[model samples]
Target: MARNPERRNALLDAAIEVLTDEGARGLTFRAVDARAGTPTGTASNYFADRDALLAQTATRVNERMVPDPEHVASLMAAEPSRELIVHLMRDLVRRMTAERSGYLAMLELRLEATRRPALREELNRTVREQYDGNLQFHLASGLPGDADAMRVLYLAMTGLLVEHFTLPEMLSDTPEALDELVAVTVERIFPAA
Candidate 1:
């Protein structure tokens, strides 16, 4: 197996783009190599098989989607309140929207997981870990939310993102719609503090 970190990352990144544009069915070693601008068989050298490529692509997409530490720290500097919760969620929507391809790639991975047990287990574990970490962060931040509240917020925000990305026409086109949605979600989830 190739041990070049940069090359591996490039291949994985290219895999993400392929997943975004082509979905799981269209993903192939040739497609990845072409997308990465590498020689034929280059992706196979880095990835053992298509499943490996898909698994690693999921990890890479998760890496790209996480919020920056600096940005999180900056937001944490302010007092936690319902309004702050709304702000945090809005920031999340903005970040996810900005990294549109990565988010879409993740969704593709989720869909692919349905047919692959190994991939399904891997995704389930990763999602659970993420949820646990998010719950911890919410508790530590004093963000005016409990575990139940956090769970609800996560589901609501995920639904909003899915609609925003996959079916934009289903929601209002007005610029304020997203903000209002986030605000209302937070308001309903967290009591006045």
Candidate 2:
């Protein structure tokens, strides 16, 4: 089948929404087709099987959540500094907060990866790609942190994102408070000399 980019992307987006609502086991070609409001067999036509659909969905979720590279660069100062790190966190929190559903679907993908080796490998590679990119950016920018610090920062930011999205009431009630949390988290991850 000749794939139209728009249609294929729409189906993948709908798949994310389905995964977000139904979890890993609930995602199916038929479900995606139904959610996308497309004719039956549409999702199957685009993807070879369940695994392919899932791998693609995970990739799409990551792609959708990335903040603009230039925006990140602008905030990350040439020297490793708390301001740069806090700025970076602010951008990430804003993006993930706005795309709560996609992030939730990504969490679902994590559960699904545990049982499927192929899916696990795909998700690992996707995550590593993002990690490597951040490391590279940090290196080039002379950011104050080693690879290990970056990993810690990533995990801390992820935890904050999960809580902020899942039980928002449990988190800071105001945007400023959340930003303060982000600043504190980043500061802890990479303490000043």
* TM-score leader: 1
User: What number of clashing residue pairs does each candidate have, in the order they appear?
Assistant: 0, 1
- C-alpha lDDT of all candidate models, in order: 0.90, 0.87
Candidate 1 error regions (>4 Å): none
The 10 consecutive residues of candidate 2 with the worst lDDT sum are 71-80
Model 1 lDDT tens row, 160-190: 9998899877874654897888888889988
Q: Give lDDT: candidate 1, residue 12.
A: 89
Each prediction's TM-score against the native? Answer: 0.97, 0.92
The TM-score, computed over Cα atoms with residue i paired to residue i, of candidate 2 is 0.92
Off by over 4 Å in 2: 76-80
In angstroms, give how far residue 159 of model 1 lies from its true place: 0.5
